[model samples]
Target chain A: MLAEGRIWKFGDDIDTDLIIPARFLNVSEASALARNCFADLRPDFAASVRSGDILVAGNNFGCGSSREHAPLAIKAAGIAVIIARSFARIFYRNAFNIGLPLIESAEASEGLAEGEKSRVDLSAGTILRISDGARFTAKPVPDFMAGIIRAGGLVPYTIERIKAGS
Target chain B: MPMTITEKILAAHSEKEVLSPGDLVQVKVDMALANDITAPIAIKVFGEIGRESVFHRDKVALVADHFVPNKDIASAEQVRIARDFARRHKITHYYEGGDVGIEHVLLPEKGLVLPGQVVIGADSHTCTYGGLGAFSTGVGSTDLGVIMATGEIWLKAPPTIRVNYEGRLNPFVGGKDLILHLIGMIGVEGALYSALEFGGAVIEAMPMYQRLTMANMAIEAGGKNGIVEPDEITKAFVKERGPEAEAGAVYYRSDPDAVYERVITVNVSDFGPQVAFPHSPANIRDISESGTVLLDQVFIGSCTNGSLEDLRDAASVLKGHRAARDIRLIVIPGSPRIYMEAIREGIIETFMEAGAVIGPPCCGPCLGGHMGILASGERALATTNRNFIGRMGHPESEVYLGNPFVAAASAVLGRIGAPGEL
Candidate 1:
């Protein structure tokens, strides 16, 4: 449950259209969306992003569209987790439903800078700045949501639940 | 303890004795829907889950309005996937080809959504059903995929925000203006995770179509859903829509002592048609204050304002005058049904004679998919929801959101003027 990665920082209201424009919504494949992640606002994002990278952003990340392409693209692009000051309600649920972890930490969102190395301890809900060693606590994922993430998304979670029988 | 309308509906659907704000509950879904843009992903996830079949065949609906005619190869592939899934699963309400329409508009029109239903769709404007007193909300494709497999969803009940509307609206000012004014008062994320319950004399007296339009924009203010308690008007409409609608209807009203997170009152008597300028739906201004802003295109369509009444209102403004020289006027009916009705009412002919280009019933330009994308630096006025940057076309292009009256008058004037100005 611990993730160590370099940070990719963004500002407020990073909308889904910017993450994956409706123009690219033709295919449902995560990789297709990953290729165009941040295509509008940050064209170089797809080419430069490496696996296990972490995304940090200010408030209202993933606003606008109800499309899950934003989080799917980010996860497929190999971003380990997203840390934001706040997130749009639908996006937050989508991220978890798809097994993409997100942490809400105003302190971490303000403390972390672009391309900085960071270690996120999901179990402890704490993030450590690699360079400065400053640590900030993130809100813990709700117990049920954590269960869904553990099962690797809602689909798998639902499958497990169905197999268990009420 | 008194419960809000949302809480009451959620509790009923979950079969729980009661529910309060922030309580986590698993609720049985009455209806689940997705469009071409979202259905592909949900279908993929549904397959990955390895479920034998959908939880309930009749409770699911899929539509292909977003890219109905297939804007491109990718969109065509997506539509094909959705079509294949629908046919393979034997979904009851699969809509495509001549029958296709925007899911939100089409669902209520066909009487699929009813009062007290806990409906969910993979589109933000699913809140439009709340106008019918249903507890409908938008979710993601992943959530929809799960809903397809198991007709249940986990939701944290949201606190209610009551919006009280009073006074009369000026001519040409309607639901679009009222919603714009509310979004202006509260920023885009003002009602985050909150249910917006619209009430008071004005909304009660408003027509059903206008109520749908008003509820459609609830997401613009980041509300989880928007609802109006069912009354005689709603009951009459439901009864006429037929026995299926009335049989499914289960109306619930908020208790008098129900607690609300916030209460905002809007006085509409003195208001004019308000416009949401470029980049955000919350950046609103009265039409009179935003004078002489020339337009490259004027679009009237989308689930937001493409109903028959919306077309009639626009036709009323464009009856004699033609669109300004060099300006393009694009009109799209919300559905094939609405298209036929508009034609029967002579609304389409008025639009054509007035120099407007009539497109088929599909959602394209509203999301910058196709049909009328803006060029760089171009300015277009539209009756659709969401005036976000690049919403209609090029990022540099701008979209001004207004009601049908403002959109039609602006088309005739080739500027951002009001119907009164014409």
Candidate 2:
């Protein structure tokens, strides 16, 4: 349950429309969405993003439009984790429902620098900066929700439940 | 525990005796909705779940809005997918063409949603049904897919934040200005994960359409839903179109001693029309301070302010005048029903006579989906909710959020002006 990655920092209120614009909504495939992640705000994001990179953003991340494409694109683009000061409620649930782990830590999102390597311990709900060895605590995901994430999102979780019942 | 209105409704839907904030409960959904933008993906997920059929076909609604008239081939294919799924599933409320409009407005207008029911939609403005006393919230496409299969979904009982707006309303200011000012008073995330309970004498006397306008943008301030207590007005409004809703209405109000996470109050008698500037709905100022902001386009429609009353108000302002020579004014009715009513009442004729373009009943430019996408450096004053950057068009374009009166006046003056200026 540990995720390690280089940080990609963003500012406050980075809305879902910016993460994946509505124009690309026609294509629902995860790869197509990943190809255009952050196409507007950062044109080079989809190209330059490396696997296992983390997104660190200021408050109210994923604020506008309830498009789950935003989180789907991030996870599809190989972002290992998202650490934001706070998130819009719908985005928070959608991210978790899709198995993209997110952490909320005001101190970490504010202090983290772009390109800094960080380690996120999902079980412990702690984030550690690799360079300076700085530590920040994130709110722990509820046990039931943690189980859902461990099962690789709600779909797989439901599939397992249905299979068990049968 | 003393329960707020939202808790009571959720408890009823979940068949629980009592509920509290942070409690997770699976509630039976009375209605589920999706638009062209989200329905395609939801249908995909529904197929992926390997379900033979939906749980309840009549309870699910699919509306082709967002990119109506099919802006491009991709968008056309998206709507075609939703249409095919709805046809295959025989969903009772499949809507397209003239029947299609913003789902939030059309649901209530068609009586598909009722008070005391639990509703969920794929679009954020699903909270608009709270105006009629339903406990509704938005979810993602996957959640909609799950609801289609299971007929229920788990939700957290949100804490209530009481926002009491007292005092008389100003002459020209209406629900749009009130909501804009409130969002400005409280930052974008002020009510994160909380239900906003709107009350006071002003809300009590406000028309149901105005209440819908106010509750529609509750999500703009990060509220799970915004609701008003069901009263005689609500009963009457629902009774006219939906006798079942009126007969089955569960009238629940907050206990006087109910606990609230926070309570914010504002007196609107002295408040004038307010506008949210470019980039954010929270960046607001009074119309008087707008300082001659020029406009390239003026739009009056959306789930927020596209009702018959909104059209009437705009027509009243533009009765004897024409839009500015360089300005393009567009007026879209909320639904085909509203469109027909406006035509009968001559509201549409008035707008067209004033040189305004009348479009179909669709959410054209609101989400920057199509119809009126702004060009670079262009500015638009619209009555729709959300002024987020690139919301109406290009990232460089600016959108100012205001009411129909301000939109009409600005159209006439070619600036971000108010009704008083007219």
Candidate 3:
């Protein structure tokens, strides 16, 4: 799948609490969580984020907490893909489990400017900076993760497995 | 290749002879856990999967500790979902009301997790069980749901980082300080996707509670898990819990020739009480180097340090002195068992005499769910795990983390001071 969007840049150690504060965690609805995405760190995120916008962040994105709410909030907030220099282990798994694509590209994370248009070819594992015509390669998603993404996340993938008697 | 304890545990559960870092394997979980914050989501996904019953009713644990006693209608609803699901599934380890405690502490206290077992929880602090030699880590709610249905989850075998702490610990320095110091040394992502196997004289001499404290904060360092090999201490602790606990327990240690991704050694002779500054646990400084930062509140509880020993330490410091006139000291014993033990030992009276409020056994203000939340400009010193931005309340509010001794002493001084200062 190809994703085209404007970039929203963030720095390192962007934690789960900042993505979706604990105050709003009582509610698990996707839209309810989306409304409070980045409620504390970026007060304008929920309202200003456009659909299909890409997020670029520094190291250890989603560092604290194992709340899937953090990833669900970002995905519901119209973030099509997250390109980070790195990601915390659990958040990396949670995002893909929910079918939210993430790319690891230090070059793209550093080279892309905020609000600049970009295109990400998910299967091709390449990122294109539309404005500057700069291209960067992302580490290919692992084989197992690629399969999960193709099946539209873990729930459906798991459902298929259970049905197939595996 | 010879294997570390983590790889050995994974290999045993996955039915593999050997495993390597970055190898994806599907392993059966000995115990699967979810709390109020994550259980509702897991329940929803389980409903979508249309599973009639959980994979193993005895293996699944649902605890309503976070925002428990129902912080609000919303939190009440979340707990209700977990309660209903637990009842529907006849989950053997459903805890609530008088029985509930922080999931990480509650699990070990009940002997639900054992050595050489692969345990997974929806909460990040699930690694706490690794202190008992279990290979435990956190996963998302959906992952828990899948595990509930299939009794298995996919995991990448993490490379192991062996951290050896030699030398005698300084006065008042404990597991909380040591873990904080380690995180400060190796930034948050230092151990990312790796298992931290703690060893050396200090770790061997450390008590079970202290070891659990260190393992509890492993996630703060971006670790997949933090483990200490099972020894006489682990065996004694498990045996005391009951016969059932010792039944399936298998103590596994890393082979002498096991490979490690990195080996880090620290001499603890000079290490003192360490405090993680606001906004990040990695922003650490020795208490001696920490400036006079006043506090609005001091919380001396959580899965990290809310054990019986932690309460004893805090009560010892607060025996005679009362909290500063304007400061709020909230003491939450980790579980009902610990609370009752404190009551039996007169520790509750010490805290009450210190002008502190004793909260029920729940997460309390750690996650900013309820209890003593901070205002915009307020600051707090806590014995809990993370001090991320806005963790305890308002976004502008700040939190500092230290040991229970520091927390109690800071309450008396109304600032971030230590027991020696008191």
Candidate 4:
């Protein structure tokens, strides 16, 4: 899948509490959570984010909390994809399990600037800056994870498996 | 093939004889847990999975700890959904009301998680069970929902990072300091996607409660799990729980020749009380080096360090002196059992006499869920894990992390000071 969007850059260790605080976790509805996305760290994130915007962050993006609400809120807030230098273990799993694609590219994380339009080719693992025509390569998503994303996340993937009696 | 303890546990559960890091395998889960916050979402996904009931009633645990005693209408509704789901499935390990405690603390205290088991929970700190030699890790709610249906989870075997702590520990320095020092040294992502095998002389002498505290914050360092190999201390602790606790237990240790992705060694004798300053657990400094930062609140609880021993540590410092007039000191025991033990030992009386508020055995303000949230520009020093932005309350509010002694002494001094000051 290819995603073209404006970039929203964030720094290292963009923790779950920063993405969606525990105060907002009482409600699990995607839309309700989306309204509070980055409510504390980036107060304007929820209201100003446009559809298909790509988030570019430094290392350990989505550290702290195993709350899937973090990724769900970001996805519902109209973030199409994320590119980070690296990701916390659970956050990486949560994002893919919810079908939100993430790319790991130190070069792209350093090169991408906020509000700059960019194009990301998820399957190809390439991130291109439209303004400078700079291209960066990302570590490919593992095959098994890609399959889950292809099935639109783990729920549908597991549904298919159970139906097939696996 | 020589395998680390983590590899051995995963291989034992999976249909494989040997495994390596990054090898994806489906392993049977001996225990699956979800709390009020994560369980509602998992229950919703379980419905989408079209499961009639959970794969196994007794193997699944549902606890209402976070935002419980029902923080508000929304939190009450969330817990109700988890309650209904638990009742519908007749989940035997379901806990709520007075019976509920932090899931990580309550589960092991009840002997639900045992050695060499593959445990999964919807909460990140589920790795806490690794202190018992279990191969436990956290998963998202949807992943947990599927695990509830199938009683299995797919995971890539994580590489192992062995941390060796040697030398005699200084007085008042314990597991919280050790773990905080490690996080500070490694940064948050230093051990990303790897199991941290904590070993060496210091760990061997460490008590179970302290070991659990170290394991509980593994996620803070981006670790898949933090584990201490089951030894005589582990066996004795499990044996105290009951014969049932040891029924299916397996004690596995890393082979002498086990391969590790990396090895980190520390000498504890040279260390002092450590603290993680605001907004990040990795922003650490030794107590002497930490500047005089005043506090608005002092919290001593959570799955991380809310055991009976932790309360005793705090009470020892607060036995005679009261909290500083302007400071708020809140203490929540990890579980009802721990709370009752504290009362029997006069620890509760000591806290109350010191003008402290003793909250019920729940998560409390550790997650900013309820009971003593901070206002803007306020600061708190807590014994709980995680000090992320706005973790204890408003975004502008800051949090510092330390052991129970530092928390108590800080309360008395009304600033970030050490027990030595008293």
Give the Å error, residue B279, model 1: 0.5
Query: What are the DockQ scores of the candidates, in order?
Result: 0.75, 0.68, 0.92, 0.89
Candidate 4 local lDDT, B185-243, one digit each (tens): 99899889999999999999899999999999999999999999999999998998899
**Candidate 2: which stretches are off by over 4 Å?**
A163-166
**Which residue pairs in candidate 3 collide?**
none
lDDT of 3 by residue, A1-166 (tens): 9989999999999999999999999999999999999998888999999999999999999998999999999999999999999999999999999999998999988998899999999999999999878999999988899999999999999999988998
Task: Give the Å shift of residue B314 in candidate 3.
Answer: 0.9
> Which pairs of residues clash in candidate 4, taking residues 3 or more apart in a chain or in different chains?
none
Cα lDDT tens digits, model 3, B206-270, are: 99999999999999999999999999999999998899999979999999999999999989997
Arrange candidates by lDDT, highest first: which order? 3, 4, 1, 2
Q: What DockQ score does model 3 reach against the true complex?
A: 0.92
Taken over the whole model, the C-alpha lDDT of each candidate is 0.90, 0.89, 0.94, 0.94
Output the number of the DockQ-best candidate. Answer: 3
Q: For model 3, what is the error of residue A112's alpha carbon versus the real structure, in angstroms, after optimal superposition?
A: 0.8
For residues A1-166, could you state the per-residue lDDT of candidate 4 as single tens digits? 9999999999999999999999999999999999999987888999999999999999999999999999999999999999999999899999998999988999999988999999999999999899989999999988899999999999999999988988
In the range A1-166, model 2's lDDT, one tens digit per residue, is 9888899999999988789977778777889999999888999999988889999999999987889899999999999989999999889888888999988888888888999999999889999999989999988888878988998887777677667863
TM-scores, one per candidate: 0.98, 0.98, 0.99, 0.99
Per-candidate RMSD, Å: 1.2, 1.3, 0.8, 0.9
Off by over 4 Å in 1: none
How far in Å is the alpha carbon of B309 misplaced in model 3? 0.8
Interface RMSD of each: 1.1, 1.2, 0.6, 0.7
For model 2, which pairs clash?
Answer: none
